[model samples]
Each structure stands twice: as structure tokens, then as C-alpha cells.
Target: MKTKIGLFLVVALFLNSCSTSKTVGKVPLYEVLVVNNDGGANIKFYEILTEANEIMLLLGDETLKKKVKKEDAQKSSFIILNAGPTKETFNRATVQKVLEKEDAIEVYIKDMQKNVEADLANENVFYPYSIIKINSKKQIVIK
Candidate 1:
């Protein structure tokens, strides 16, 4: 009986070792990339939080810094909603209605292909929903 019990324990341990589990996280799951295209090429990443009026900037793979940038947070959420899976299934009118409630204004920018292309390859460094371009005058431009 002792030998049988030992064998069972060993088998259990082996089985447990073979079985793997991954704890999939939900919060802090969304990512946005901020690329400085005003000829500076200063690239950055942030974890967007729409409800709390704050964002956590991802400095590196393991470091995150939180800041309260309400305007940026709101705009980022708006762009994501307009550019994400919801837009793929819903009509423009429906999406507009949802966005209207948040007072999310549409940002427009033109002739940014040369600037945007400069940092296109850097996008691989972070997963961004959409990148906003800033001009020399520090104006937000959406390309």
C-alpha cells in the first residue's frame, strides 16, 4: 500500500508538472503608442484609461509611469472606438451617437505622410490603436 501511494503521488506530481496554466489579465490590457512626428522622433507608449481621466505611460517593457492627461485620454478613447472592431460592425450614425455623449471631437491633420512614415517602423515597439501627429506649433494632427 505504501509503494502504491508513493507511485500515485509521483504520477500526480508528473501530471501537474505537465499541465500548464496561464492567468490572462483583463485590466491594463489596452495599449496606445504616441509617436512624436514633429521632426523629433521621440516615441512613447501609454496604457489608456478612459473612465479615470488618467494614463499610464509605458517607459520600457517592464516600467510604467502614470499621469493625468484628461484631453489625451479622452481623445485616445474616441479614436479607438472610431477605429476599432465596433466601427467594423456598426454604422457611422450609431458610432457617432456613442461618441457624441463623450464630447469626443474629431481631430484632422493633412500632409503628414512624410512625418508619419518616418516613425512607421518604430510602431513595432508598441501596439497602438492610432497614432496622433503633433506639428511644430505643438498642434494635434490626425493623419
Candidate 2:
């Protein structure tokens, strides 16, 4: 009876070991590329382009196509949002998370808070922009 029990335990352990596995995650869930903020006086401040046509229209060129390889015009959420023209060149921004909710994908960003006071007319301005690549194309909203 002892030998039989040991055999059963061995079988059980083998089965368990075969079934155990570590969850493998997809390498890149999303990609972010900081473009620029030179469009300082852009009246249309922040622009998030999720489709190829819109990106082409806004950029008026093949810049987006050149950036992302194997481009999926329908499912590409490319962000060209401007964030600059500030006095501080050392300021920074970070991409926190990108999530898909219903028909839209939200892009979360952490950036240094700007001063409440308006910039003086003569203050040096800088343009800071970034491009976000959503894994699946959909509406890209910045928050």
C-alpha cells in the first residue's frame, strides 16, 4: 500500500509540473515616441490622430507612414499631441498607461505641472510633442 501511494504521488506531481506555466506577456503593449513641441503657437493645441488618413491630413505628408512600420491605417492610433513652448527646457513627461475601454483607447500621461501664471510675451517658448502608438487602432483620447 505504501508503494502504491508513492507511485500515485509521483504521477500527481508529474502532472502538476507539466501543467504549471508562467504567464507570458506580449513584449510591447504600446509604443510612445516624443515628436516635438515646436508648434508652439498652434491654436489647435493637442491633436491625437488614430487613423492614417487623419494623420496624413494633419501632417500633410508621409511622416506617419515613415515612422511606424507595417502600418495599419485602420487600426493605428498615432498621437502627435503638442505639450511645449514653456520656459523650462528641463521639464519632462511620462506615459503612464494605455487602456482600451469600449470604442476608445485612453492614453494617460504624467507631466510636470505648468505655472498658473501666464507666460510673459517675451518668455522663451519651447514645443514638446509626443507620438503614441496604440496596439489596436481606435479613438485615442489623452487624459
Candidate 3:
């Protein structure tokens, strides 16, 4: 019985240690870039990350929610930026370069648009694109 109890305690401790939640914290600098495809209609592509290495999709934006509702953005499929292709990669160098030339957020969005254009072009599909930038740090929230 003592051995069984010890085993149970060990398993419980192991499980407890394994179970964890993501700790959300403020990054020194973060940016959010959005790309709206005219073809998708209601969806907007977003790429968000911080200098601290935290990156993910943003599904809950009150302002964007309102805009989506007002602008009928629900019909569209909003995609998070994929970090695969060399040109599509969102890294510190690209971010810094954009920040140096123009607004960080603007540069991010422009780069996103350019990436999308290049992607579509590689596929030989032509379409219109629009890029929007939210430069404020408040634009990126950790959750």
C-alpha cells in the first residue's frame, strides 16, 4: 500500500509539473501587420510578434471585431502569416529594415503585401491586395 501511495504521489507531482499555462508578458517592442485580400472579401491576414520572440495569431480584437461587423469582414478567411518562405519570413532584420525606412508597422504590412503578391505571382494568379499597419504598442496584446 505504501509503495502504491508513493507511486501515486510521484505520478501526481509529474502531472502537475507537466500541466502549465502560457505566461503572457509585455515585450519590449511588438508589431502587428495586417493584409486584406480583395478576393477573400471578409478575411484579413495578420502577422503579429514581439522582439521578445513571442508570436501568434490574434483572434480577439475589439476594434477589429467592430470593423469586421461594420465592414462585413466575416465572409472572409483571415489567415495568420505563415513563416515558411524566405520572403515570407518575419524576422528582426526585416522588421528593423522597415522601421528604419518607414514606420515599423507600415513596413511590416508592406512586406506582408509584398510577400502575398510574390506568393500569388509564383502561383501565376493575379489579384488586388491592401496592407494596413497598427504601429502602436497597444495594438499588440499578450493573452
User: Could you tell me every candidate's TM-score relative to the true structure?
Assistant: 0.28, 0.57, 0.24
The reply for model 2, stretches above 4 Å from the true place, is 1-27, 35-44, 57-66, 113-123
Per residue, candidate 2 scores C-alpha lDDT tens digits across 1-143 of 99999999999999998996899987465777545544443222456666576755634445555655544456565665555556556435557898888988888888772523334364465555666666776667779
- Model 1 score (lDDT): 0.30
Using lDDT as the measure, name the better of candidate 1 and candidate 2.
2
lDDT of each: 0.30, 0.62, 0.35
Q: How many residue pairs clash in each candidate?
A: 0, 6, 2
Write the residue-wise lDDT of candidate 1 on 1-143 in tens digits: 99999999999999998898987964331233332212222232222233323332322213222322334433344222122112122112111111111333334322212112223355322122343211111222232
Report the number of the highest-lDDT candidate.
2
Residue 126, model 1: lDDT of 18
TM-score-wise, the better of 1 and 3 is 1
For model 3, residues 1-143, the per-residue Cα lDDT tens digits are: 99999999999999999998899985323233443222322222344443222221223553344333222232222224332222322321123322322322234332333323334445332233332333343333211
